[model samples]
Each structure stands twice: as structure tokens, then as C-alpha cells.
Target: MRTMSITNARALIIMPAWNEEIAVPDTIREVMKYAPDCDLLVVDDGSTDSTRAVAMQAGARVLSLPFNLGVGGAMRAGFRYADRLGYRAAIQVDSDGQHDPRDIAKVLDGLDAADICIGARFAERGSYKVTGPRKWAMQFLAFVISRLAKVRLTDVTSGFRAANQRAIRQYLDHYPAEYLGDTVDSLVVAIRSGCRVTQVPVEMRVRQGGVPSNNPFKSGIYLARSGLALLLALTRKRSVLTKLEG
Candidate 1:
């Protein structure tokens, strides 16, 4: 495990919101309730809705993107902000409210001994209200990632995760922007770069809105594309290793 400097131990909570006007405020409020000391940042990914206004009103610093960037882009923006502000740790929480904000503490707790901490909803003790196909896809991706990355991850695509400064620097340097299916790409990069990753149980709720961005068909295509990408990533040698060693 990489040893992080204790002097720079501030934690920043980042929410990458696209069109979560209704749930963003509540998510921010819940996160603040649990992790009161952490600073909150909401990266509005060119939302047509009032996501920026709602997030700002809910007491979060908003990073408004001029155009719609995918999840990876929004998260890269958040990581850049955290790096610029010199924050020691960053926790990513989705604004759709599918992930419980109260579980932020659990992620942080897991981060104490690891470079990155992931919140695994399936490993937790709670009911997950998701479509059958999506659930099965998650399980399938978990198995694939375990084989390719050599890490036993229960929730390979979970957005609810925490990363320390080492991870923040590494991701800001080499985050893949296009065809970012899920959080798996970032996790794979971190793990390959010699970061210690740990998973904790987290309760997940159904989206407050009845609709989800991913339908069964779209999700299936995403899974296929991401699976291929992961295989390619695994076959390639570690670029991060060369940089770190050099």
C-alpha cells in the first residue's frame, strides 16, 4: 500500500450530475449529514435541467461544463478540481440518489488502509431495486474484472467510491475519456498502478425518479463494449508503471 501524507488529509466529496435536478439537492444534503467536514463539489455535465442551481442552492461548489461530457469527463473535471485545490481524498457519489449518501462514511473508513475504497451494494445488507438484466450484467462484469485485473471486486461498476491523493494524481494523468462504460476503467488503472483497493458494504436505493438512464438494451451493448475494452487493457503492459519507475 502507498503511504499518503498525513498533513494533507482533507476529503472532498464530488457529485457528477447530468440531469438530476430533483435528486441532486437531496443527495448533497444527505452526504453533508454524514460527512459534515468534507467539502462538496457538484460537476454539472451540461445538464439541460436546473442541476447547477439546485446543487449550488444545496451548498455545493458547482463545476459547470459547457457541453455534455460523459461520466468519465465529468469525473475527470472533478478530479482536476480536487488536485488543483490540493485535497487529499475525493469521494464520488452519483446525484441520481441510487447510491445512499449516508454510506459515504463507510467508503471513507475503508479508505483509511487503502488507496481506493469502493462501495459494493451487493455485498451490503440491503434490498437493491434494479432490473434483473442490469443486476446480472453487474455480476458478469464483476467476474470479468476479477479475472482480468486480478482483484476480487463485488461492484466493479459502482460510482460510489473514494480515492486518496495518490489515486487522484494518477487518474488526472491518465483517465480514458471515450466509451467509458462504467467506473471499471478508473479502478483498473488505479489497481495496475499499485494502489491498494478495498471494498465496503453500502446500501443502495432505487433511483428517486422512476426512470433510469440505462435501459436493458443499451446496458447490454455497454456491457459488451466495456468487456472488450477491459480485455484490451489487461493485455497491454502498464504505462503507469514506467512513469512511476522513471
Candidate 2:
């Protein structure tokens, strides 16, 4: 429910696409409708489909990587692009169309104070279903992150998030190169570097197209690996995420 006047257009919406040709257009159009002023970038992580062409036709600037870099690597490229281009802030939206474009504005409202703002579905309970093992996994990650962050966070694994320039810089220099490690470790690095983190309630939808990259087996593996990453995060040295002078 937090909001700020849209005085400047410094926000960039970044969608990381890997074989998401089926849903990319709708995702871009919905984002364009919701945040018309912001620039859109689709980081095509070497998709075999027409992802690059489709995104371009949908009126997005596409950054096609040489090969598949997975979600984390693609997102890192987006942040780097935004940083280099002098964008003040950026938002990461899923290309699978699972995240609601309408709720993007709500996350942006926290940018005035937060270095990064996460869209947490659990904040609203019945708004979205966590279901079974994924539910327990989320709780454990949230507990670890919140306790380390010294502030209560309801959802830590949620991909829907916003970041200011300082955060972009932080990720540019010290972003994790692993799978789910990027999302989990990047936040810890931001906090360790004294950057503000925040969360807002958001509703999520079932993915419209493209098979999920991770199955239940992969999810379990990710949870186990991410758990170890969290423990190591506690002792990881802080990266320089402070705002720099012009």
C-alpha cells in the first residue's frame, strides 16, 4: 500500500527468458500496460525458441546471451545492463507469467527507503498456495534469512523483487554465480553491506506456459544446497554496496 509520486522514469523492468517464447509477449504487454513509463529488457538466456525476436516484436529491448546462463546469470546481466545505462532502479519480473504485473507498482513504492524490495505472497496468507514440501522449505529459508537480517521477513525465495542503484552495484561486483544461490546470497550480501531490504504482499498466479525448469526433485536439491549457502552467508565478507559519488 506504500506509494510515491511517479516524478521520474528511472525504473527498468527486466525479464529473464529461457525458452519462454510462449508467454513472453503477454508478460511484456502486461508490464507495458501497468508501467508504461519504464523501459523493458528481456534477457534471453540463449533460448532455442524465437524468444529474442518475440521479445523485440513485443517492444522490449532484448539482451541475448551467448549461451544459457540460467535464471541467476540472466538476471545478473539485466542488473549490469541497468547499472551501466544509468538507471536508478530496476524490477525483476518472471517471464513465465506467474507474477502479476499489476502488483509491480506496490513493490516500487518501497524503493524510496529500501535498497531492495521483495514481493512476499505469504504476507497475505490465503492469497497464494505454498503447498507441501515447498511450503516447509520456504519457512526454513525465511527463518534463517530473517534471523540473520535481524528483521522479520515472510518470504525469502520469492523472485519478484525491486532494486535501487546501490543494489545493482552490489550485485554487479559480488553476485553469486550459482543457481538459487544468486537470490539467497545476494540478499545476504546486500544486508551485510548495510543496504535496506523490504517485502510487500503480492498475489501470484499459475504459470501460463513453458514447463517449469525445476521439478520436485530439483526443488529438493535446491533447498538442500541453498541451506548450505545460507550457513556460509553468515561468515561471508561484506561487499561494497554503498552509494557512490558521481
State which candidate has the highest lDDT.
2
Cα lDDT tens digits, model 1, 138-209, are 777788767655667888878888988778887877666666533777677667777778789899887875
lDDT comparing candidate 2 with the true structure: 0.83
**Residue 117 alpha-carbon offset, candidate 2, angstroms:** 0.3
| Weakest 10 consecutive residues of candidate 1 by summed lDDT | 237-246
lDDT of 2 at 148: 71
Cα lDDT of model 2 by residue, 9-97, tens digit: 47889899988889999999998888776888999999999999999999899999999988888889999999989988898999989
Clashes of each: 0, 0
RMSD of every prediction? 4.2, 2.3
* TM-score of every model versus the real structure: 0.86, 0.92
- lDDT (Cα, 0-100) at 209 in candidate 1: 54
C-alpha lDDT of residue 208 in model 1: 73
Q: In model 2, how many backbone clashes occur? A: 0
